[model samples]
Target: MGNKTALYDKHQEMGAKLVDFGGWDMPIHYGSQVDEHHKVRQEAGMFDVSHMTVVDVTGTDAKEYLRYLLANDVAKLQQKGKAMYSGMLNEDAGVIDDLIVYLMTEPGVAGEWFRVVVNCATREKDLRWMSDQTASFDDVALTEQPDLAMVAVQGPKALELAKQSVSESRATLIDQLSVFQGLESEGWFIARTGYTGEDGLEIMLPEDEVADFWQALADAGVSPCGLGARDTLRLEAGMNLYGADMDETVSPLAANMGWTIAWEPQERIFIGREALQAKKEAGISEKLVGLVMESRGVLRAHQKVVVSGVGEGEITSGTFSPTLGCAIAMARVPSATADQAEVDIRGKLVPVRVIRPSFVRNGKKVFD
Candidate 1:
């Protein structure tokens, strides 16, 4: 048995195939992963993402502390409810974890506050790092919201179907929410952010009420999806999965996450800024790029990527793209690798085309 979310019984009742993911017993699929994946891409689907870790930071120094903790600048969030994605790094500039932090309080307020959602597998280490970084900031405090549950409703019709499950006031707010923005109302944090490369909302509400909400969405005809579909959807969207794409030993520059770092305000320093700056000065040798194979074969992680004359690399995450009808991957390769590469599959070298990391967006192929 593994740690179960508040909706464990609900998932079982829906005939979901449950699997252990990072110590949590999660639904891998209800009946068909391919079907579920198509549902999210072509129509609407909901995923029980309650196992994700949610933490709230509040106090006199919350903003300053965050600005000092994350690689991306939270100071850039000039309005309340705005969210930004960032990587929390160690002293060596290696990615400790990647997360989305929302500015919960009005900008420039004395009571600085923010909400951060992190990967559940890195809960202990991320929390410890966050706490230790706050040692110098006497006014900051961390509160974990273990009592909350999350659900992600995604696809083109996701917003309409999800709105049918919430209160009228919330529905109105959900309609008004802009992409990458999150707001709190009636004890719920509804954000228009998702991992599936579709228009969606990730709502965090009380655990006690989440089961009913999930059922309500089901009654409204929203498909209940699981982790298997979630993985393919995110991978197709070119989003990086922690532990697979990068970790404590990999630099953000090599993870296709360099855009997430904030380099300005040279005087204001974050935890790993110095090391990252040093890396920048020394030069970046490797980069993460996309791989596309137009054959009838599936791609899997850890496959060797041989860039002829350049060097060897490995696929961090790979999957048969449901939206593109081809195998797509994200691989870490030598900085000079370009245009073409090959993946070793069962001792056979299969040629692949390398392009920008993104493969699909809004159910459309993004690469040329």
Candidate 2:
């Protein structure tokens, strides 16, 4: 048995197929995974994301500490509630984890605060690493918010239906939240963020309040989704999974994360700055790219990718895209790889076309 979230009983009541994910008992699906996926794309769906770790960094030195901690400059976040996606890297330029950090207060102001949300699978290691990095900063403090529960309400109608579930005041606040921004109301943090590549809100509230709120959203016609659908949705959206897409052994340059690294203010030294500079100077050997199967076969992780005369690579994350009606994948291949390749499925070589990593966004095909 693994740890259970606040909605464990509710999931059981809904007949969710439970599976152990990163030592936590999580719902894989309620009944049909495909239906849940379609529900989110066509209408609205809610997911229990309480298993993710949320840590609040506050104090006088919060900004300075984070500037040194994340590859992306938090100094760029001049407005409160603004968010930036960043990769926390190691000294070797290897990706420790990719996370979203929201500036809770205006930059350069006293008592500036930042909120970081990391993946559940790397929770323990990430916390330990973060603590070690911040040990030298006496004025910085890290507080883990285990008492909070997070739910992501996503899709076209997600925001509208979600507004009906929250307080009237919060609904107004939600209406004002811009993309990649967040606001707090009535002790709940509502962020205009999601993993499904759709417009939605990720709400974090008191653990005790989540069940009722989730139930309210369901009653309001939002479908209850599970991790199984979440995976497919994110894949279609071209979002990277923590472990499957990249890990401690991979550098951001090779992981389709180079854009997240802030290079300006060149004097500001963050972790892995030296290694990343060296990698940049030496030229990256491999790059992460998108693959679409032209032949009739499913693409999956660990499948060998043959880039003709270039070199071999492997699929990092692949799936039968429900929205695209075909197989799509993200793979790490030689930087010289062209627009065509072949994937080794079982013993047979299947033809695939290489393109930009994104397949679909906002229910439309993004790549040709």
TM-score of each: 0.99, 0.99
Tell me how far the alpha carbon of residue 74 in candidate 2 is from the true structure, in angstroms, after superposition.
Answer: 0.8
In model 1, the runs with Cα more than 4 Å from the true position are none
Best by lDDT: 1
Identify the runs in model 2 with alpha carbons over 4 angstroms from their true place: none
Per-residue lDDT over 115-223 for candidate 2, one digit per residue giving the tens place of the 0 to 100 score: 9999999999999999998887879889999999999999999999999988899999989999989989999999999999999999999999999998999899999
Count clashes in each candidate, considering only residues at least 3 apart in sequence or on different chains. 0, 0
Quote model 1's TM-score: 0.99
Give the distance in Å from residue 363's predicted Cα in candidate 1 to where it truly belongs: 1.0
lDDT of 2: 0.93
Report per-prediction Cα RMSD to one decimal.
0.8, 0.8
When summed lDDT is taken over every stretch of 10 residues in candidate 2, the lowest stretch is 103-112
